[model samples]
Target chain A: MFRDIAEWLANSPAREFSAGLLSSIPGLPPILQTVHLLSIVAIMASIVLIDLRILGLAVPSQQLDEMIVRLRAWTVWGVIGAIISGILFVLARPNRYLLNPVFQIKFILLIGVLILTVCFYRWSAKNPFSHEPGNNIGIAKGVAVVSLLMWIVVVMAGRWIAYSEYLFWPG
Target chain B: MLNEFFLWLEYLPLAQHIGATWWFPLMESLHVVSMTLMLGTILMVDLRILGFAANRYAISTMSSELVPWSAVSLTIASVTGVAMFITRASTHAVNPALQIKMLLMVLAAINIVTVHCYVFRGVVNWDAGKVAPFSARFSAGCSLGLWVGVFLAGRWIGHIV
Candidate 1:
């Protein structure tokens, strides 16, 4: 059954799409994964610092905007890491990855993270919290909370992909 | 000594299941992902402290802000790391390398805790002499060394004992 599905995908649009990606970038995928991992490390640090602040675990005296400014470079680095690694990983084994449900979920969560970052973190060097200190209570907190949650899921799903056996799904 | 450790850690149950099937590969990948995620965050924070970047942004601000994310990332890494451990309980439980790794982890955790406690505890005490106190710098440096050891030990599990 799995073989048959693989065969079908071989002729399908996805196969062509994945093949095209590989053809376009011969040795880029592995390099992307390496860089991606490194960037993720950087981003993770920035994110946790900010998130910890949100949870009030440590260092509450600093302004939220100031924190964001400092974290910006790292956050940007992290996003770049995740995106490139993800694309490269996907390209390396597109059909199998696309067939997996976990990948789908990961992409969704990734989108959520991106959206959250964009919604609140637009400026290259400004803080969203300073304009309305008290109003920064609920939604701002929710954004931070969900951003962390989505990243967790994304990492889990990425790992789960390696473990999954169900390749030919929704046929 | 290393060979003897190699003999010791490759116990029966785990020895039988190191590469038994597809699940091991999956779990291993998950373990990598979880670790990378955690390490990723750690790198950012430490870099900030070292003044690699984020100079304008106060250390306290960055530290407080990243606290929540760090907690969550670490939680995920620990949970997945344990799951990986369960897959090979007996051998890993007694393995010298794992023991060393665990010790390093404890040390790392202590450093992190100190950062939050005595080091970062008085953020409002910002002063001319107050960029990152000696204690904070030492903790950060310890944190880096411990985590590197952790990563190296983890990868060395395949070759080392």
Candidate 2:
């Protein structure tokens, strides 16, 4: 099923156009990659700050709710930019990404992290500690640690995509 | 000459090992991790100074809390970066993208010092919920642009070579 989907995407007109355009440009792929990386920096940094706050390790003077509000825009825009750039990258070479196990792992990690992040945000919004300044809830700290670890894995998986050929791949 | 030194460095056992083994990709991954941490923290602080984000927090407070993470990440990044460079020191040393990245880093350091010694000294006056003075904002803007340039140049090094 996965191979079929990848094959279909690879043969799609959109992919053909994207591949042609990306190939025609001398350095467009790297430029898109740069943007993708920049967006990752934004996302990772925002996540780090929020997680640190929950762990009582950073910005102790600021209220959690307020801090979340402050970082929301950065996180939202970063995700938007990353998604757009990531889709373009896949469109440029659908099979290269869609069929790669490492890419599949990265995609899974990204989805998991997004869901975790949303749930954590919603939970914090309702939690009392969020309104209280410098107060770190135990549950939130646990979640923060998990969140940090998951993000680290996501980033590692992202870097590994380039070297996926060395890893276990049946095809 | 510096080229000879780089060549010598590249021949070192540690550099040779990194060049020959799987260590290169591992170190490269670590480099990316640290880069995000360093850049991310710096971005927040810069955005704060520019009155674009986290306005309610005092500039000093945010800097004090966040800069340490940025500093630590910078240290890790520098270490991994040097490790990677030594593996192919002569080639990296001559890479124009790398040279530009290094120069940008120097400028960034200078900008940080200028902020600490000059713009930041007056931070107390407009530290919280206020637009910082033009000098401070200008420094912050420069910091943002320079760091972005550094990242882009660093990325181009692989392609350029």
Task: Determine the backbone clash count of candidate 1.
Answer: 18
Among all windows of 10 consecutive residues in model 2 chain B, the one with the lowest summed lDDT is B121-130
lDDT of 1 by residue, A60-96 (tens): 6656677677777777877876776576446546567
Cα deviation of B41 in candidate 2 (Å)? 0.9
| Top-scoring candidate (lDDT) | 2
Pick by TM-score: which candidate is best? Answer: 2
Stretches off by above 4 angstroms in model 1 are A1-35, A55-58, A123-127, A165-171, B1-41, B53-82, B89-149, B152-161
lDDT of 2 at A31: 82
Candidate 1 structure quality by residue, lDDT tens digits, B8-51 = 54554664465465556555666665677567556656766766
Give, for candidate 1 chain A, the lowest lDDT window spanning 10 residues: A26-35
Give me the runs in candidate 2 sitting further than 4 Å from their true place: A130-136, A169-171
